[model samples]
Target: MLVAAGVVIAALTGSAGCYTDPGYKGRPSDAWIAQLAAPGLDGRLDAAAALGEVLRLQPNAPKVVTALVAALADTSDPVRVAAASAIRHAGRGGGRVREQLQRDAVPAVAALLADSAHPVVRTQAVAVLRDFGPDAAPTSAPALAGALSDPDPFVRRPAAEALGALGEAAQLVAASLARAATRDGDFRVRRAAAHALALVGGPPGTVGPALVGALRDTVELVREAAAEGMGQRGADGLSEWTVPAAAGAGDPMAMLRATATADPNPRVRIAAVTALGLVGDRASRPALRQALADRDATVRREAEHALSALHRRGGQDPGMEEPSRADLCRSNPGGPGC
Candidate 1:
């Protein structure tokens, strides 16, 4: 083994004379190639660094990608690190590298996602799946949804975030977020679900309820995300919120108004009001008018204007209008509004 290492090294450094030793798996030429490819040695930063350069120099090399994928199977930390970096590099460039990532065994990829002890490796694995995007189609969604239950947010957050990029995967993962928002123990997971919901933006049936529920979430960040997600779902369905007949008297707007008016976190309260506007109904007049009296001056002004628009349109309105920047800001402060 020592002699083999020496021969590989000698060929890499170009010290071997012109020779054909059949016994050497790696001839002098192979050594130079290996050196250029520069697979990292046992648990050393430099080896990982050199392997990174090799990936850059030969981005299209199938052997290098395969070798890196194989490295993940090793118990050696250094080799696994180098391998992870190499796969990440390949994944970023797409094309052949992306294909390779998709073909990699589930357990190998799952190991990288599940093992939180190595944040760098776990992040890389999630990133690879993210970059794979459409190419990852079928597998990406399932892998990410599964990761939502991971022991670590470092892994789970990225997985949730990655799902946002999967377009078609949105519907499938929406169920997971719906479930997670209600049951996940970590505040961060709930927050991640809200963020993922924003990325998977769609119609009212798909995003509205989840977002509305998020407004009432115990965590402030999740509430913020829910508000943002609603805005991203477009400004159509929520237009009637400013009218008297909108969403009916028992509409969820009442809940949003209560939160907007009195939530402990000023931001969450603001988000609640903005959500009400997005779901605009004439019946919201009393609530929005009540908001005008809010100590938060921003909420007061917006409430007055949203009421004005709803009253002007009456019942024949298109149920969709671009909310003025001033009005949106009043409800959400810095939030992304209609």
Candidate 2:
């Protein structure tokens, strides 16, 4: 039993030091690029490794990224892997570093994703594409969506994430993602595809009703993500979903209230409450008030906060049984309402 438990623990949560990503060590000299460009193999190898670590830290300098992109072509496998690692780190800032990477590094790194010989090289290259978000969509989405069918869920999961980052521009792969979200054998791939669809095609009229449909997913995380997507796109109206007839009210608020008060998972309930708050309509007050007595303390607290916001918004019944702002502050003390 002890050995079984230990293995489960290690499998679920890897041991320490796993948090630190592998990359080049040491700071880059101003002439680090020149060193990589230098004639000697030793100098170039050392420079590539150091720059890979620097890129792991995500330095936003244009020249540094430009130089790193140049390293992607080096004949040495270490240099190519290190450069890919750095390029992955370099895209976090979302501006010039991202643009430079999109222009110069994406093609090389993406090509490395198919390297066959170096799997980590491919994984690191995929990691780099994650930072590109929507900018890499045109060049990156098709390949990423294609990976959704990979035998390894590990590869499929990150590909879904990158596609999700592409957001609306990932319209081209919406059908593929919808298929993966529902039919994929791996739970992680199903969860990731469900999540990616929320971002890629969840809006009311975009590509399809995949996000709303995800609300019924067997996976708890997928359902939670779907609720969040509905909330984000709910705006002044919840065109993404219609209130279920069983909820007895012909509005999304009815469905939200049902999901909030009755959903089994606390996270889904919390997301439903958050969506109500985001909707910020007077109709939500009754549900928020009902949620005040919810089984989960967090749900109760969230209900209090939502009611407070509703009061502030001049809800349907200011004079009803709703608590005043001061009362809410005392109830959930230290809340933003205070």
Query: Best-fitting candidate, measured by lDDT?
Result: 2
Model 1 lDDT per residue over 1-338, tens place: 00110111111122222322221222322342354344444333344445455556545444545545555655555555565665666654455444555666233554566555666666666776676666565766776787788777777777777776675456666777666665678777777777676556544454555655666788888887665554344345353222234434223345566666777776766665665565555555666666767888766665655665564456433444445677655544655553
TM-score of each candidate structure, all chains considered together: 0.63, 0.67
lDDT of each: 0.57, 0.66
Per-prediction backbone clash count: 15, 3
The list of candidate 2 runs beyond 4 A from truth reads: 1-45, 53-78, 89-100, 115-119, 165-176, 200-208, 232-257, 281-290, 318-320, 330-338
- The C-alpha stretches of model 1 lying farther than 4 A from their native spots are 1-47, 56-58, 92-94, 105-111, 114-120, 165-168, 201-210, 235-262, 272-293, 300-338
- Candidate 1 Cα deviation (angstroms), residue 48: 4.0
Clashing pairs for model 2 are 24-49, 24-53, 88-128
